[model samples]
Target: MKKTLLALLFGSSLVLAACGDNASDEASDANNPQDAAESAAGTEIEPEKIVNQKCSSCHGGDLSGGMGPALKNIGSQLSEDEILSVIQNGKGAMPKNIIEGDEAEAVAEWLAEKK
Candidate 1:
């Protein structure tokens, strides 16, 4: 009887462990930024698209500078945090709060990786 009880308990514990693993996997999927963005936008959010839509007018189509300063090598000129701050808050002739939230974060991350 004791052996049967032990087997049952062990089986229950294994089932519980499997359940926990599945829950964690679901939670991680939910937390994925790209997945969240795609759900919200009904499509994937491309960082380059955001840049082109919002920045291309002044920065030029290729980010090689036009009315705004060149951004082709901005990654070497500024840290990611600095770039994010400048993007969020604006600097010089740039208007403030041009981008915000996740889109801003994605753009900043993309630009910071240009180097």
Candidate 2:
């Protein structure tokens, strides 16, 4: 029983460590900003920031999907690059040229593989 409990605790710790890493990654993604000029120059921007600045306006708070489609599981449905392109270029009622350069990339990353 002692060994079994130890193993369980160890496994739980590993899971927690992984979760922490993912959380950190998410936080890092959010804090990082997209350099519009840099993106135009070929550098990509972080995704979370883009969602906060540009997407929250229409996509509902926290990507709940208001004027736009819900993005909970978008990442599973579409590739990161595809989402980035669509946001950058815009489609239909989305209007073109809303998000520029790295901002587009950031928003795409946030939306990609959501859920």
Candidate 3:
């Protein structure tokens, strides 16, 4: 299920990128995962550091749950896209944009692998 969703998103992104003005650049980006990710977010980010610095305090030092919900198995409950949305938009008592841009994308992708 996770693979299927990731493949779908990846395929969709490639298609969208291909539809842009610079087809050569887009096509190359489609063939390069690192490039695609960087373009999608702006730059490469260290998610673990971000999580430790920003999320550990609220979610628990071990991420087992503290002021916020347990994130140990967050991917079982939310997809990367859904997690990104929550990170960007906030939920319940969570505030928006605790992290933004590439940092947020990196964190979402990492957390979505917990399952």
Local distance difference test scores for all models: 0.77, 0.65, 0.81
lDDT tens per residue, model 1, 3-112: 99999997776445322343554576688977656666656558898788678767888999986899998999988889999987788867666778787888888899
What are the per-residue Cα lDDT tens digits for candidate 3 across 1-115?
A: 9999999997776444323335676898999988998888756578987788677766887789876899999999999999999999988867787778777898999999999
lDDT of 2 by residue, 1-115 (tens): 9999999997776445322343554566566655334434666465676566556656766667876776778898889998877776676556555667656666777777585
Record all residue pairs in model 1 with backbone atoms less than 3 Å apart, i.e. clashing.
none
RMSD for all candidates, in order, please.
Answer: 20.1, 14.3, 15.5
Worst 10 residues of 2 by lDDT: 14-23
lDDT of 1 at 34: 78
| Cα TM-score per model | 0.63, 0.53, 0.62
Q: Quick one: ranking by lDDT, best first?
A: 3, 1, 2
Task: Tell me how candidate 2 scores on lDDT.
Answer: 0.65
By TM-score, the best candidate is: 1
Weakest 10 consecutive residues of candidate 1 by summed lDDT: 14-23
